[model samples]
Target chain A: MAINPLPPGAGTAIGIDGLIALLAKLPGLGPRSARRAVLQLIKKRESLMQPLARALAEVADSIRICSTCGNVDVQDPCAICRDPKRDAGLICVVEDVSDLWALDRAGLFRGRYHVLGGTLSALDGIGPDDLNIGPLVDRVRKGDIREVILALNATVDGQTTAHYITDRLGALNVDVTALAHGLPVGGELDYLDDGTLAAAMKARRKF
Target chain B: MAINPLPPGAGTAIGIDGLIALLAKLPGLGPRSARRAVLQLIKKRESLMQPLARALAEVADSIRICSTCGNVDVQDPCAICRDPKRDAGLICVVEDVSDLWALDRAGLFRGRYHVLGGTLSALDGIGPDDLNIGPLVDRVRKGDIREVILALNATVDGQTTAHYITDRLGALNVDVTALAHGLPVGGELDYLDDGTLAAAMKARRKF
Candidate 1:
């Protein structure tokens, strides 16, 4: 997304070129890779390319921001928010939909989610008002929520945003917790940083 | 394109998941990268995602394989084939449209192109009939073509296809040429292969 992915004479004018330009904007694909992707699409139009086009169209028209939880889905409240099995009283807060997908994919959480869209960052001028924090706090204030888990990234911006959200929901009579920071699963101890080593040692429990 | 790029429980059922699966089939994007791309798309639906969907639709509806030169474009004859500025008497034959694009991007060739679709490969079960070889020969038989330059890749399959095309058009009143083999521009001599070194030595000429 940072680099110009269009060729010498290519732009958004031609449909093929436009597709290439748009594909180039996606993460991990530069202009050359986009061109290769487009060529492969063209080569396999029936099996891959046309199907992808239809899928993109369908998602574009159907995918919506969940009014309750901020997850992008075909429904207003989202599939997770609508699910009867998921615990509505427990909400896992995340910085983005990507984070939501990651947590969901892992099958680590059985509760609903509240996507903040992004962490609060002064450098990028991202504030509380810009995110979906108000809706989250309102959901908690409506009173069924028993606990809020801060599943944000362990970065400065992530911690800052988590602290701010904690303060906002301080008077709501809900328990606020955070994900434990330690060596990740399958992580090599020798390759880990000092901070992680320290955290892992401090959080070590009896076997 | 080799690896199945999706995580567990992600597939072509849900719109977002479908988009991710389709994107994963692209050359470089796998399931995880596809998820990241889809998430990024969802995050910027208006500026990027929706536009990409629209472009894909437009291309799907408008793109046509050129009947004359086998190029994929908006026109049947293709823009290059229709252009009067290029030398119609000369044709550069390539294995695929991507090869054509690469050559065209260089701005080195002033003639039109003939895309073979693919080279003849016994391992892949590809024959001369599988490619657009007959059309190439037919084009030469029509008598306007003065020279047919084989610009296929410098692989065994490429050479075999080129030789097959040359033999097919041997009885015709046209000259068949091929791309010279030597050290590529900006390619270091120290890193060159023995075959390439031998070829470069054999093909050496006055500087």
Candidate 2:
């Protein structure tokens, strides 16, 4: 993780350094990669960077969180919540908006989503109140949701949050389930951990 | 590469899919990473994305190439070319603006620069006239320049362009030099090719 040696007032000019600094903070980019990206953008300013800048502005201006499901979109209820074809009775709960986007990219789930923002982290002082668990329970209590799928990550905090949500929804008549734990597609058995292997073995299905 | 399965009118919201598609075309980003970046941007719209949009607009509006050195900057002459501290007798010739940016990041060279835009690639129909070679030669022929350092890449085209420039500047009194060819710092010997090894041996110096 080498820091960008070029400071603000160095040989590099103007907003270019600032853009690189901001781009470097992205999830998959470091300073070097950010510099490369910025150069590429500057070189293809008309074709790429300008369009991206415009698109970013448009998205920034239009995007908002769905009041119903907590998903970010251009509309209040979001496209997913507004879609008439998706199953409103099936709500998929995820830790963050990124998780929702990932599932959407998979194109497998045809249900609405509930973004919890983050899992219940006792160490980090994140409780059920800090998340969207209350709203999710309220959605279930409205008698529209038939199934509440806990599609959170297979982490300690994720599981704890799921359990807490289940407890909160204990009085509801809806069924609750979780994503199946098993070897991922194209995954090798040798690379799997003990917990995953145990869970896979316990839940083994007949072919 | 896995194509993004999410189509234009799929469950994903409007403008978001387009943004992801455009972002995926960047140098180092893939569809998955682009999706993650977009989600992150949307998540921190007020703090990060909005500011990025503003900075991008500002840069796009202000950035232009310097007439003398071809360096991209907010000013016409560019800050470097207008600086009175730098050496006017030395000029570093590079293939593209990105190369000039790389050298500027190094912060070692006090001389100005000449961006050739591209090498003399016969395969791609690029020739001496297509690049900024004529202007470079004109600048050298003016007799103020004492040295022209060829800071092009180690590629075959780069070397060919360097040779062509050398020939073009032959009638002038300016001295032409190139970056030294040797093993890069922190490079593993076993991983190096025979050409690099030979070059390193031929240019060996007593420590």
Candidate 3:
């Protein structure tokens, strides 16, 4: 039998095999999608492949963690932390940089952000030390931050982390607040779970 | 509004924005997944992002089209075409390199391949002259090939291209054959379409 009778990577170019292997490790991309992507990328070398390679290189070289909030960016403190117009007095706490991105996508949050990096997970052995809860407490104590909003997900780990942070900042004199639980914007009563319906009813506002 | 009140790609590092845009352009990777992938890439910079960047750059720099088979690799003849063990007398023609990869994945076909690049599409203005059909005919004419297998998709354009190629190679004295159409392996009979069921019944073998 020939060297590559089993398909790619086995007999393909070293560069292609390496690229496919790395691409497959990405969040949503599997081995099959990675192979297809490599083919398309090579086909569109000038238009997409070269540019993507350059971008990846530049990002890998320049990307840095924000010492202030655990956010990843090219700069030290990050853009959000450096922005003068943003309300530094109000800080929104989140579990990950993805959460920060999600909240920022709404364009409604005007305050600065504090990325916890992760939440409390007993099963995974993650605790307060593994998170950035210490830095958050320090920021609240040192700065004029009046309120700290917990915008974590509704998951058990997320809520547990939120509560843990709330308790940690209780002595810091900062008004710790959590996001209001309610039915989603397009969520129907019939489709919503009992927890969501109860929370929506409990937080119901009068017209 | 602040520089990046609307989220990423606006003021969040030019490298990151460029990476996300290019990643989102890939198949199956949308804007949301792209952002998440970037975040993960940055987080796992040393192991994933840096290595991925190097891999991308290497692939972009070294990748080349197989002059003989239209397969994209780091070599002109491609690994499959250059393999001495492969049966050069038998050629499997496919619409694209993706099809070539799919066929090779089965590891059953021990022959060379001819990538047409794309199928004949009158609607899209794609014709025999636009594809690698000329090169394929030349390869068959010059080489001592005895059989040509049309492994094109079952789509209208695919079948049309297959017919056109068959007519072109009719006088070449090569035995032209197409893949047998039948119900796919692991496909349930109940889920099989009418056309597939009919083909399966008609192509049934001796018990």
Candidate with maximal TM-score: 3
TM-score of 1: 0.90
True-vs-predicted CA distance for residue B77, candidate 3, Å: 1.2
Better of 1 and 2 by TM-score: 2
lDDT of each: 0.87, 0.85, 0.87
Best by lDDT: 3
Q: Candidate 2 lDDT, tens digit per residue, B121-172?
A: 8899998888988889888887499999999999999999999999989988
Clash count of each predicted structure: 2, 0, 0
Please, what are the lDDT tens digits per residue for candidate 1 over residues B112-194? 99999999999999998999999988899885999999999999999999999989999999899999999999999999999
By DockQ thresholds, what CAPRI class is model 1?
acceptable
Which stretches of model 2 miss by more than 4 angstroms? Answer: A1-12, B1-13
What are the candidates' interface root-mean-square deviations?
Answer: 3.8, 2.8, 2.7
- lDDT-best of 1 and 3: 3
Give the lowest summed-lDDT range of ten residues in model 1 chain A. Answer: A1-10
- CAPRI-style class, candidate 2: acceptable
- Residue-level lDDT of model 3, residues B122-170, one tens digit each, is 9999888999999999999999999999999998999999999999998
Query: lDDT tens digits, residues A12-72, model 2?
Result: 4457788888888778999889888887888888998888888889899988788989988
Badly placed stretches (over 4 Å) of model 1 are A1-13, B1-13
Q: Every prediction's TM-score for the first chain?
A: 0.90, 0.91, 0.93
TM-score of each: 0.90, 0.91, 0.93
lDDT of 1 by residue, A105-173 (tens): 899799999999899999999999999999999999995999999999999999999999999999888
| Candidate 1 lDDT | 0.87
